[model samples]
Target: MATLADRLDRCYSGAIYDVMRDMGLRPGVLPRTIRGLVPDQRVAGPVFTVRGRPDPEVDAHTSLLEWTGLLSRAPAGHVIVCQPQDDTRALMGELSAEALKLRGVRGYIVDGGCRDTELIIEQGFPVFCRYTTPVDIVAAWRPEAFDEPVTIGNVTIRAGDFVLADRDGIIVIPADRAKEIIARTEAVIATESELRRAIRAGEDPQRAYLQYGKF
Candidate 1:
């Protein structure tokens, strides 16, 4: 069986995204609070997804604590992707990152916001998000559920989907399509390489692109 890290290292966010786009599937972004701790650190793993809706009346401090506890039990290399209804709150921070790190998590992809940017960057964890903020998730919001489906951008992400994220962005490959996508992606890479070689050898870029259907 291939480990999560192994699969992640084998693919790039761009390739996976292209595959999904070609297939007409839209995937969402992981929460922004979850970030990378290392430089150039990309994570590929099965998503242990969470969905949170706005609840100004509920106290989220306790909910976050409990959520972190649940995440600690996630299988090794499981990437925790959270979708908070409100993109403004900083749902992830140093403490949460530390806990996830201990659990052998691959990384995080969030659409909201994050804090402790300096520490997270220093820790060399890979995180992808819309922005960073100093505000924390506390009295503002609560985690309404887990292991549920969420949407980011045009992508629909469900728990257990294979997630590959890098500097370009995040891509979710349905669990059932992992092997197929991997095979297709390999062919794409090879074709692109050949096309590049042809271009370098003085072939017209347009001709090369048309021949391979890729630039």
Candidate 2:
């Protein structure tokens, strides 16, 4: 049987959004600032959440070690969702992206900044972030927590939740409800496909919606 991640990977973000809304799980999309660097790249996986901030007491040496540890321990087939409280510096760079890819990390989603845009794009490692900057977390930033809940754009994401992202946007599904959401989304896709066919065949919009109960 296909895993939850595999099943989610087969659906686009729009369908997932519709299914979640129909199920009453509102506020699923991440902030508009977080966009895929490669808009065509679609990724779906379990979330490995990280929450970070600039610490006045954590020295540079210790901060580096802490950040390194967090990345090194990222589980295979997971997407790293980070909420770095500061936006002045990049939380992810080329080396980190390479390491995550080597460990089978599906992709990254950061509600902050990222660097090494050219190389990251060339490598085709899917990354979604607010923006890019040359400044990095060498001095004061450190992850305060991992594998915990983090909020981005009013959507609370917890570790083990499912993330589906594409050119349209990113949608987070509650882990317990992911399977059911996927099943519903498949039905939605099928209905939409048929609706498209009917419209192209010159069927009236009102009749189509009446027949399909959707349009």
Candidate 3:
């Protein structure tokens, strides 16, 4: 049987959002400023949330140890969603991305900066962030907590919540509703296929929408 993450990985962002809205969840969309560096790639999985901030007083060595510790603590088969809370320096970089990827981490999404863009992109790792910079989080930042609640835009995300992201945008789905939302989205997609065929077969668009109760 496919796990919820596997099933969700197969669903697109739009359909998932529509299903959640129709189901009255009214899910919170992640900030538009935060977008996938690899737009053609889609990543979906349960989140391992990281919340961190700048610590200028910390030494570079200590900050690096703390940074690598974050990577080490991330569980395999999970997407790391981070609210770095500071945009002055890159929160992710080449070595971090490579480490996370080799460990079977699904992806990285951060509301901050990323360094080593070319290398990370070439590595085929999924990274979504606000921007890129050569300046890294050596002594400028430190992880405050993991698996704790973090907010991005209007969404207050918990560690276990499910996330589906693609070119359209990213949306958070409460873990408890993953199965229900996925099942409904499958039904909606089937209806859309039928409606599309009807429209292509010369049926009036409005009539097809009426017939299928959707368009």
lDDT of each: 0.72, 0.90, 0.90
Q: Write the per-residue lDDT of candidate 1 for residues 1-215, one digit (tens) a residue.
A: 87544855687777766766787766444434334544376888888887776666766667566566656655667787777878687767887777677778877777777889788777776666667889876666666667788877667888878887766556678877777777777677778789989999999988888888998
- Clashing residue pairs found in predicted model 2: none
Off by more than 4 A, model 1: 1-5, 21-41, 54-61, 210-213
TM-score of each: 0.81, 0.94, 0.97
Clashes of each: 23, 0, 0
Top-scoring candidate (TM-score): 3
* TM-score, structure 2 vs. true: 0.94
What 10-residue stretch in candidate 2 is worst by lDDT?
18-27
> Can you write out model 2's per-residue Cα lDDT over 1-215, one digit (the tens) per residue?
98889988989988888788778878488987789887797789999999999887888899889989988889999999999998799999999998899999999999999999889888889999999999989867998899999999899999999999899999999998988998999889899999999999999999999999886
**Higher-ranked by TM-score: 1 or 3:** 3
lDDT of 1: 0.72
Clashes of 2: 0
Model 3 clashing-pair count: 0
